[model samples]
Target: MLVESLAVLTLALLVEAAIGYPGRVYTAIGHPVTWIGALIATLDRDLNRDDASPAVRRAMGVLALVAILAVPGALALALQAILSGFGLLGLLAAAILASSLLAQRSLHEHVAAVRDGLRAEGLAGGRRAVSMIVGRNPESLDEAGVSRAAIESLAENFSDGIVAPAFWMGLGGLPGGVLYKAANTADSMIGHRTPRHDAFGWAAARFDDMINLPASRLGAFLLIVAAALHPWASARAAWAAVRRDAGRHRSPNAGWPEAAMAGALGLRLAGPRTYGETIVNDAWMGDGRAAATAQDVDRALALYRTACALLIGLAALVAITALALSR
Candidate 1:
């Protein structure tokens, strides 16, 4: 189990870094997150009835979360048992499945698209590009706002998309990773506090928050270390910002990485922002420049890539250590 787990973690990182989830594969099978999303959506539509009491809706959410987790959890166990028989071939298949659960490449692509859009078409283009990735009101964003939004999304997603999944995979192998993904996908699909989801999505939101706790801190730690390596970013500032500002965000977990990234890059993030018709007066992270530009976005991406590399290297070291200890 340890050997296969280690093998899957290492190869999945390499595979995702190299090609990501191929568009062809996505076109064929949709993505695993999307598949998970469909299930969540189905549950939300069927079970999250307006007539249901708040307590009942919340219970239904818990049941839905359990149902979503059980399917992938069982499959992961089965796959591990079957692969344990085939040796290296089984490990390779497990690695492939694990890679699908990661979002390193996709995250980069989505953020890069925002940068490119800003560069190619100015504020309008940048707003349109960033809107695809963020739930904020794009029309209200200026250039700096758009750039900050992109950087914030990159930082937050790094924790949720990359670090969180890898953290689970190390402990629970492929199913652990998939289980985390399911929780995350459910959170995104139905976890909002709006009238439609506030009650029904309570469980999904809370579960996602609980599962992401450790990875969020780990991700922030990696970003701080990565900042030490970059001439432009400050490790001290990252740590300081994380301590000071992470608690200010609405989410119990997301602010850690966002604050770290903001401090590392010397750019302020998570300030007052518009979300659809609402203006969220979020506390600003990092006492740095708020007027971000395309160059800042690029710099944030550079910091992000370094952080990601640092994370993968650490994961490799952990895998090696686990394999050695198991032996």
Candidate 2:
């Protein structure tokens, strides 16, 4: 069962990289994340009450997390069981469904758009493109700020949007992936330090951090290996930065990839940044250039692509080994 799950994960990664989630399909039925996000919104509206005590809200948040995971988890389990009975055809169907959980192609496109915006439309264009991917205030960003924001988003989402989901699916199959996505979606929606969400989102935020721990480290290793392969990137520096700086970022998981990418590409990332009117004074990653350019965005994309390729290779190797051992 574990071997089959790994195989399905490998296929899902390949399929997502090849075609992505098509716009037409999304327009017609919406994407899986959107579907999950809708449920999260409903839960937040229904369960999270403003007048409730923090302790009560925290407990409600835990309940909400379980409810959020159960619906998709059960559906994925049923689908996986039914498909397993169909053998190869069912495997293909499962892979296609699992592919929706990854964001390889979409992440590339969105980050590339920032570079394009910087090139064609200057700071305004860069800001516009970057605003789509990052939570930071776009208007506050200069050209370098926009570039850094895009690269940071790219690195962080590389872990969250790809590695983490793929890691879970490889371990526990379709239901695992669905459940991880559900928890991650909930975290993003409510896991802020705001007065309303501080207690209510506690469980989602903590669980997300715990589940992401392994994938975060694995993702950093992948980026370091990718840096070794690229003439322009530095594997040693990447490793050094991760060792020196990963734990400094606000998020325990986000720091690993961000540090690796920053070190590999020889750029400083994730210093002080604004989200709305709030400025987060965070530690910088990598002892390199702070004035990141559109060109640096391109460099980060190259490194990202190499890291993604490495992830695919790793998945294939695991699937093969798992199958052989099972046999």
Candidate 3:
């Protein structure tokens, strides 16, 4: 199982990098997170009642979160067990299933679309492209605003989408990745502080925080290492920014990579921004220029690519080491 797990980690990352989650596969079965989101939505609608007390809602949230986490792991483990008997075919199947949890290719594509849009159509296009990846209000963004938003989303999601799942998969195989994706999906869908969700989503939000703690740090480390390889990036600056600014972010986990990216690329990120009509007066992540442009986004993408390559290389090394030890 150790060898199999390592093989799945290597193959899944490569497969995802090569093709992403195919549109046809998504069209046929929908995405795994979406499927998990549906279940969370059902629980939210059914159990999260207005009449329920705060204690009741919080307890219900925990129940829902537990079920969400358990179901996916059980299914994946059962599938893995059944497939293991098939040898190589089982490994391939596990890899395919695991690949669905990663977003390395999709993340790059989405960020690249923002760069392309800004280059081709200016502010409107950039805003439109950035809107797809962020919850912030797009209409208020100038060109710099759009670029920063796109880059910020890229950095933050790079942690959640790539590092977190990969970290879990490396340690716990397919079921670990599945469990992580489920927790992440739950956190996204219900983990909010609005009047409707604050009490009910407490468990999901806190649990997500706990799970993401280690990977978030690792994500920053990877970005710093990647920055060292790129002429335009600064590993020293990335580490400095992480120390200075990661704590400034609202999320317990997101600021690490975002700050590292900001410092590495020498661009200020996560300043004041609008979400719908509300303006969040957030502290800036890096002390660099606040006036980002499409070119900055492109540069960020280049840095992201290098970081991703570094991550894959690290995973391959780990897989190779595990294989050697297993012998």
Candidate 4:
């Protein structure tokens, strides 16, 4: 299972390396959340009706992952035997799914649109882009705030959209990768600290944390490795920033990629960002390079490119290792 998983992931990654994203990726925009919601619904169905504590929510979250791995993985394997296109199709699907998780081109373009909008139209145009990509309050944001929002999204998504799914696909297969995305979507939707969600979404949040644990660190390391490739960002500085700042964020995860990205991009990231009406004072990540301007956001976009290429290399390595083991 492990060997097969690696080869398939490698093949998918090679497609990304060789050709890049196909044109139809935008079709699934924000739609993974629907599949993710369905998984949470299944867990909610079996959740202990007796005690709806945080513990129970967490148990349900685990059960959701178990549910994800069990069903889709079996179907994919079974389909592989009878279907000639199964392997390639599965590989393609895995690649597309993995590509969907990344925001290199999309993040860059979207943030650039915001910057352009700010220059061309006004704050209202900036708000539109900020509202679309970030979970923060868009109306109150100025140019600096808009840049900050975009930068934060770039850093955090480096973990969620890219690292987490790729790690799972490398560890498992297409179904494994897709399932991880679903788990992430569930956490994003249900996992909240609010009274309405703290009980109901508790399970999703914890599971999200668990799944992202290793991937976040890997993402940080990969950022350094990726920076080393171009010297656009400092590899040693990324390591130092991650070691110094990753633990400061509220999440056990998230901060690794953010810190690495900040160091790599040579910008300060994650301080105070508004979540809806809430103004949370997040501790700073990175080496506190506060000279960040709108252009810094643009450079972070380039860092994302490096991270994407680095991920493809990692996938190829995983594939090669798998093939060697199979022989």
Instruction: Determine which window of 10 residues in candidate 2 has minimal summed lDDT.
Output: 318-327
Model 3: weakest 10-residue lDDT segment is: 1-10
- Candidate 4, RMSD to the unseen true structure: 3.7
Segments in model 2 whose C-alpha atoms lie over 4 Å from true places: none
All candidates: TM-score: 0.97, 0.99, 0.98, 0.82
Displacement of the residue 160 alpha carbon in candidate 1, Å: 0.2
By TM-score, how accurate is candidate 4?
0.82
Write the residue-wise lDDT of candidate 4 on 1-327 in tens digits: 677677666666555445545456535454444555665666666662545777766666567656654565566456544443676665565555555444455555676777666667776777787788888889777777787677778777777876787788778676667667767776776677765456666666788899999989987888788778765668787888898999999889889988887777766778887877899899888765655556777677777777777777777777787778778
- Of models 1 and 3, which has the larger lDDT? 3
Clashing residue pairs found in predicted model 2: none
How does model 1 score by TM-score? 0.97
Clashing pairs in 4: 57-203
lDDT of 4: 0.71
User: How does candidate 2 fare on TM-score?
Assistant: 0.99
- lDDT winner between 2 and 3, please give it: 2
Clashing pairs in 1: none
Query: Which candidate comes out best when scored by lDDT?
Result: 2
| Cα lDDT of model 2 by residue, 21-67, tens digit | 99999999998889989988998999999999999999999999999
Report lDDT (Cα) of residue 16, candidate 2: 96
